[model samples]
Target: MPNQAYLRVAGLSKRFGSGENAVAAIENLSFTLDEGRFLSILGPSGCGKSTLFNIIAGLMAPDSGDVTLNGESMLLRPGMTGYMLQKDLLLPWRTVADNIILSQTLHGVRRSKALDAALPDARACGLETMLRRRPDELSGGQRQRAALVRTLQTGKPLLLLDEPFGALDAITRLHLQELLTDVCMKKDKTVLFITHDVDEALLLSDEVLIMGSQPGRIIAHYHLPQEKPRTLKTLALPRLIEIKGEIMQLLDQEVKRHDPHA
Candidate 1:
């Protein structure tokens, strides 16, 4: 039997404004992510990638359809998923450790207990030595790492990441990409990541969904090989390269569709 979907978006649609001037950010967008699976979404800008994420994260409601997680409706539970944006968005006044446990604190977890729970993830993300430091004291990569730890510490089954590494340098981005996959897999967290980078999506995803613009919708989906320890070496494989090329072509088409003059 096919794997059951841990998270399902069914005929989801979202619109802004009304009447003839109305705009549809998402239209009949649908996809399923299996439990503990890593799915990445690739699309051109204005493709409603972020909008879709916002709806799933329960920050926004869809005009129609529903979003369910673990067989339960997520639409009724806003903030059910752990969400991490491109910027670290850590509280500069709070120490790294404090920031990491911010969500737990909000959920009424005692600080001491939260820290105890956060320690393992902190160390795993290489933030153990800097926990006592403020966000401004850390490098860009360090900050994002702390943000990631914070997201994981929420103990949410699903994670919604919006280009978390987009602003980082190439080297730092690669390191965090590897760290993220390792951490998420070990924790068995389902992730829905949005990225403009095709290689990054292929490297970190169990499956990739390509989206088209002008009322965003899925254009194609590819299930990747179940290769362990997916690294730079994996991206170099001929099959991966072929898949990457195809994804790039699809994205290019979407870009032209959005702007044929370009």
Candidate 2:
């Protein structure tokens, strides 16, 4: 009845250490992202958000459960989806164009073809003039743009973004958020975004999932109206404001629960 999920995580659990020192990072967590949908995850610090990203990205294996795309298992393997991390992680030695096409080259795509595919993305992200420049020569926002271009160049159906704009200044963060939304919408890309910023999640997500700490699990889900393009003005909407307050209260309660002195 619901739109068939393009990506699904089922009964996922993960733990670290042993016996007394054992810590459960994620426990029985599960969710689905529909095709061409944008989903944002929000939670208190140390809520296993990045752990979930790593599991979905196939960078790490869960102690239990599986990640599936189109009903195929995507476990214990990397490169199943395009991932943009908190840091740009661009190679300083490589030029902007080279970095943008790195994924293509790794996937055995010919250099010429990779460049051809990445050029337009680079231009779209305003990196056309700096194509030949090394990562060190680019500004923070520019480096992040190049990283995003590189991720998208992989042509993966699913995109995993873990606070890609968290390191940038406020102005640059907003600019990149808008740029990311525009690019994803144009491409009809499915995205799973993780962020600590409530405003960012509300502005960009088709739906927002709130998580609680100490064995992270979904505490609430909010489906946002997608009829209008999300922008800074969306933050001021009464509905968004109401939802933001609700999420903030939940997050505050989570923090207090974990604080010994509270």
Candidate 3:
């Protein structure tokens, strides 16, 4: 059986413009992320994947829909939901530790206390030595690790990730995905991460949603039966590939469905 769900999205729908110009990004879209579980959403470009992300992050409003958190209705706003983007978005002048505590300070957490609190998790992500270093001095993976830590520092239950490692090279991307899976599990965050990469999504998500384009909707939902402590070796498991095939087949038909005239 599946784990108990902690985050539930009901009848979620979003649109842009009006009348003929209006396009539904994701309509009547819904899914659940159990407490401390990770979910990855994958689809072709223009699939409204990012738009769906915006609504979940509360950066944009849905035409009609609502998100519930840990059984209570969520009142989402900027800073309430910690979002990590494709870029590290780190400040060059600030040290890693400073960046982590900045949000806490803004949320009225005392600087000294926030720093004291972040040390344990920061060290867990391989940032113990780099906390004092500038962003320019860190490797790509290290920088992303900081961003992940900073996201967690918000102390929010959900994390919206928009291809947080998509820009990195293949080798780096794989390395960071494994590292990120470890970090997120340790933190027990409910992650709604977006990705166009199939293997990455399979490697990280406990559940994978395969989305279709324009007037977008969920075409298939895959529940991964694997347990936690997933490693790179998990990718080689036959079951992983089997489920990945199902998602790929859905996407394949989705592309043809959207471009039959082309």
**Candidate 1: residue 192 lDDT (0-100):** 94
> Residue 163: error of model 2 in Å?
0.7
Candidate 2 C-alpha lDDT tens digits along 232-256: 8768888889999999999989889
Cα error, candidate 2, residue 45 (Å): 1.5
Clashes of 1: 0
Candidate with top lDDT is 1
Q: Which ten residues in a row have the lowest lDDT in candidate 3?
A: 71-80
Runs in model 3 deviating more than 4 A are 1-5, 260-262
TM-score of 1: 0.97
Of candidate 1, the 10-residue stretch with the lowest lDDT total is 70-79
TM-score of each: 0.97, 0.96, 0.91
How would you encode candidate 1's per-residue C-alpha lDDT over 210-255 as one tens digit per residue?
A: 9997798999999998575598888999889999999989988889
* Collision pairs in model 3: none
